[model samples]
Target: MKRIVIIGGGPAGYEAALVAAQLRADVTVIEADGAGGACVLSDCVPSKTFIASSEVVTGYRDTEEFGIHSDGLEAVTVDATAVHERVKRLALAQSADVHSKLVKAGVTFVAGTARLGEDTLGHTHRVVVSPHGSDSEYAIEASIVLIATGATPRVLASAVPDGERVLTWRQVYDLPELPQRLIVIGSGVTGAEFASAYLAMGVPVTLVSSRDRVMPHEDPDAATAIEQVFRARGMTILNNSRAEAVTRVGDGVEVRLSDGRTVTGSHALIAVGSVPNTDGLGLTEYGVTVADSGFVPVDRVSRTNVPGIYAAGDCTGVLPLASVAAMQGRIAMWHALGEAVVPLRLRTVAANVFTDPELATVGVSQNEVDDGRVPARQVMLPLAGNARAKMADLHDGFVKLFCRPASGQIIGGVVVAPRASELIMPITVAVENHMTVSQLAHTITIYPSLSGSIAEAARQLMWHDEE
Candidate 1:
């Protein structure tokens, strides 16, 4: 039987190990940070758990419009301690569940960090495994090696994370109490989502963006809508402002900007970006190509230049998403086992930013069309006209579709609304199946539903293009 060693027990490593075990291979996973990596134990799962609470608060705040009223009731106070406890417990529970699954699949779980070394059979890899807090290293042999090591929040010396007054994305969950005022630096997805979440939780928030607007990566209209909503909620927004450094003030924190502007807040959350965890992994010695930003270079099949060595997840730098990592893992296993496998097709993947009015997108964008890469026409439908949005008081979102000008084939789409991730599936399906906008327009969506707006947008696009 073939022996396989997978490093980093994130979604990629765990899922790949499961597939290898099913194929009757002896599989072992070496993970230093336990199961689920940052996605479950720290980033995605725990953060979403807190966001779920924000959804409840938002629902309660908007309940009065539905003719429901508590005569003298006020906004329910948030217990940060309780929230932290639940977040940690749920993360632990999910991690335990993953561990159980690995056991059931007969995959060996090694609690350690793994580095690739010499190959035993030109195909067999020697892995140096060092357990956390231990000086000893164990060498293991594997016919195939997969690297699923993920990324970490980038830290700058000017604004180091003290895990107290200044915090990284993961450390914020450990806060004992809500900050009197929280200043978030960076207006990207991570920054915007956290700012929106805290604002929804009734915390005073100031979003500092160096760009001209928030969510600069998203659609212009979508970004505008989010900015308007954040402003309307009494959240302070500072744009065209770059933080020079974050220093601890007497009892709070002060962020000094490059333009001689200073802002004070009880706490500061850094969301600039993430650095791929690639160092000290022995990749350089093995001639593994790395990108300028230090991400491992791999082919679509997740194979490195060296034979029998594979890399996946954030380390590959394809897309820093848990779902993408899981898929890459499975694809690596399939290709390794000589089974039919398809290369990673990022254009068909759907991604979402889970803020109040979520922003989700799939495939290409209009910007690509304007760049003369993809010839496409666009159509957008405002949610304000949708009956469902009217009932739900959702007036600040839209669905936009991009399609081939002549073929009418759906190429990509973006949906900005509540649960936009779930709503984006139809567009994902259309893009994957090459369904035309006219065909999508014919599909029946329930009346008085936000989903209807999606179809309507496609219909409007079809009409305008007359394709």
Candidate 2:
């Protein structure tokens, strides 16, 4: 039986353990953090839970839009402490659940940090597990090793998180009270998400964007729509401005911009980005090529340069989504264990930004088309034209489709709407399966649905093909 040791209990490590166990490999997972890693324990699950609460707060504010009248609407309030408590409970519960699943799968779960080293003969790889807060260490011989240590939130030296007045994305959920004025620096997905969530909860939010627009990496149209919504809803956005330094000033925080301006708020969130948690793993000694940014370099199959060693998750410099991490883990196991495997095709991956009227996209994008990287024709259908969107009073988003001009094959799509994460699935499927616009247009969709807009976009693409 093949012995496999996986470092880090994040989505990638745990998922690979399960797959390796199913393949009858003797699997052991060494995780310094609890099971489920940061995704469940702190970052993704916790932030999304907070967003879910904010969505409820938004729903209460929109009660009148649904033709429902309630005298107590004015009395509705959000309890920040209670909301945070719920987020913590849900995160912990999920971590425990992942632990249970790993145990049930018969994968050995060790609560420790792991470093790669050579065996006695220097012919095979071995793992040294060092339990947290302990000086003792033990070594395990492995035929295969998977590294999925994940990442940590990037913090600028000029702007350090005090975990009080200033916070990182991971530190926000533990706050006892919501900030009256929340200033989020960095208009990437993390910054935008927290800003939008806080705004929905009735907090005054100021979003600082170093770029010209929020979510500069996203579809331009989608970013514009979100920015419009933010401005209309009373959220302040400072574009083309970079934060120079953050300082605490009399129970409040002051963010000095590069332009010699200062913005003060009750609390500040530094959402600049993340750095891979790849340090101190002894990877360099073992011939693993780590980038200057500490990210491990891997092939499409998640293999490292050294034989029998693979890397996945954020440490591998792949897409940072938990789904992508999990898939990379599975792919690593299959490829290393002599099983048939498919290399990751990032184009078919769906990514979502969980803001109000969530933005989700799959496959190629408009920028790619504009840059001439993808030879595709595109069409966009407004959600306002959909019956369900009208009923829901969602006038802010659109469904855009991209297809090959000659064959009409669906290449990519973007959906900006409430629950856009769910709505982008069909587009992802179409892109993955190489479905054509005509085929998508022919599919039956329920009346008065957001999905109707997707179909309509495809039909429009079909017409464009004809023309």
Candidate 3:
């Protein structure tokens, strides 16, 4: 059997390990953190779990339309401690499940740090591992090596996280209680999600954005819709404001902006971005080229510049979504083991921002179509027009579809609504399969469903103005 050694136990790394084992290769995974890596332990799982709790409370808003009133109950309140209890519980359980799967798949799981280089015996195709909780080290010889070490949240020198008043996205769960007024710096996906979650849970929030709008990287219309909701629900959005420093003052924290202004809050969350966890991995020594930004650049097959060295997940600087990372991992294994491989199609990748009214998209974006990148006919239908949306008393968000003018082939789509993440799947499938708008329109969706808006948009897509 061809031997494969994978570094990191994240979705990318563990997924690769499972694929390698299925291919009948001897596989080993070395991870210093838990089996689920930072994604499950701190980043994706915990945050989403916390958001799920917040979303429940968000539904309580405007319930009077459904004959529900606050007079029936004392008040709807969130217990930060209880929410975090569930967060940590689910996170740990997920880690354990991933660990069990790796073991069941016959992949050796090693709790240690891995360095790519010659072993003690001077074997160039060997990895030196410093086992966790032990002083001794060992070496493993593998015919192929994969690096899925993921990334770490980037920390600013001027604004350090105290794990209390001032915190990073990863440090927020450890907070004993909710902040009186939470200030979220950076209006990207992470910042927007946290701000929306907290606001929905009745926590006063201030969003500090360096850009002119929240989620500048996302669709403009989508961002505008979210900003409107945030404002309507009493969120203080400071667009075009850059945080220069975040320092604790008394029991709270203060953010000093670039323009000599300060915003104070009980806690400050720095959601700027993250850097690839490439240090101490000896990537360069093993002939793997890393980018200046510390990311390991890889192609669609997840192969680095050097043969037999594949990188995936956040470390590759591809899309930072967890689903994309898992796909990259499977592609890497298939290519490495000589299986019939289909290259990763980035265009069909679905991305979602988990907020109050989630924003989900796939394929081409509005910017691309408007900028003459992807010429297509488009239609956008408001959720207010949907029967189910009216039943739920939901008025925000829309379903948009884009199709080629000549052939009516669906090229892209966007869904802005509650459970938009789930609603985008059909469009993602339509785009992935190169289905035409007619094909999608002919399909039946439930009468009282938000997803029916997708079908409605598809029916009207080909007749709309071409970009």
What ranking emerges by TM-score with the best candidate at the front?
2, 3, 1
Global CA lDDT computed for model 2 = 0.93
Q: What is the lDDT of candidate 3?
A: 0.90
Task: Summarize candidate 2's per-residue lDDT along 173-239 as a digit string, tens digits.
Answer: 7788899899999999999999999999889999999999999999999999999999999999999
Candidate 1 scores a C-alpha RMSD against the true structure in Å of 1.6
Supply the TM-score for candidate 3: 0.97
Off by over 4 Å in 2: 71-74, 119-123
1-467: candidate 1 lDDT, tens digit per residue: 99999999999999999999999999999988778877889999998898888887788765677788843125478899998899999999999999999999999998888898764555578989988888998898888899999999999789999999999989988898988899999999999989988988888999999999998887677788889988988889999999999999988999999999899999999999899999989988877777789898888999988888899998888898899999999999999988899899999999999888898999897678779998888888888999999998887888899999888899999888999989999999999999998999999999979999889988888787663
True lDDT of residue 64, candidate 2: 76
What stretches of model 1 exceed 4 Å from their correct place?
Answer: 71-74, 119-121, 132-135, 465-467
Candidate 3 regions with alpha-carbon error over 4 angstroms: 72-74, 119-124, 463-467
Candidate 2 TM-score to native: 0.98
| Candidate 2, run of 10 with poorest lDDT | 67-76
Question: How do the residues 86-170 of candidate 3 rate in per-residue lDDT, one tens digit apiece?
Answer: 9999999999999999999999999989988753343226888888899988888878888999999889999988898888988
TM-score of 1: 0.96
Error of 1 at 390 (Å): 1.0
